[model samples]
Target: MWELACLRFRHLGVSVTPSRCYRRQASSHIYIWDFLTMKRLLGLLALSSLLAGCASGLIDPNGYDETGTASYYGAKHHGKKTASGEPFNQNALTAAHRRLPFGTQVKVTNLDNNRSVVVRITDRGPHTRGRLIDLSRKAAEQLRMLRSGTARVRVQALNN
Candidate 1:
């Protein structure tokens, strides 16, 4: 049993020799804390993985211009933590784009009404297929797209 414990720890690249292994035999029950230790270890691994992905996925915003469907998220997501680690504010002029770096500002224009608003990229996505960007409630209101719920829009990244 001690050999198995040593082997398991070694599998995780941990230097656990036979002499360093702890064995507490309480009657017929032998407690192996690998389950608890692995649980916490896995959680840390997951968190680091997410951070690494976010760091690498940000793209250069220069010359980024596209026209697609735009949608807004408000009350339901207000005060929620955004991908940038800041709490979302529905009244703030902010937005989400799949690849634009956080803090990048973009101008979004509603094609139907020719209304436009400048919004900071604060979060990650629209999460819906065929969508180009996600706007905050105030941005959508300024763009005159609140009544339509969705709008055909042009998004152009601004140099900052």
Candidate 2:
């Protein structure tokens, strides 16, 4: 059965030398059928690892600990692309700052409500009037400022 499979693979331009294949199978407890199954399992594992990596955000550009207030941006600029080339999803637990760099984790506290939330700085902003930092919709909600839209907040840097 193994020989027949090898012959078919060879006919299809796949390289399946009998000596090499037998040697590989002999080194393990797996039979020829088991070897084929293991190969498919390994391929699936490799593909999943590649996909997991692609789903992550870019590396933080600012490179170290930094702190500032976190305000929220919404309505007028909900679907715009951020500095890291990701669409600004206001509902996500994200933030934007002028020089904090992407992926930096910050803890923002609302002075009025005494509420706080930690968020990742995933973009660059506050180019408007008097804003210190920009928070995602969810982060602002956690800070109890979604209704007001802006909060007087204290942002602290956290060490990874």
What is residue 69's positional error in candidate 1, in angstroms? 1.0
Question: Candidate 1 has what TM-score?
Answer: 0.72
The candidate 2 region of ten consecutive residues with least summed lDDT is: 57-66
Clashes of 2: 1
Give the winner by TM-score: 1
Cα deviation of 58, candidate 2, in Å: 16
- State how far residue 66 of model 2 sits from its true place (Å): 8.3
Candidates' TM-scores? Answer: 0.72, 0.54
lDDT of 1 by residue, 51-153 (tens): 8997898888999989999999999999999989999999999999988999999999999989999999999998999999999999999998888899999
State the lDDT of candidate 2 residue by residue for 24-87, as single tens digits.
5443323445767888999999999976764553334433433444568866668899887888
TM-score of decoy 2 = 0.54
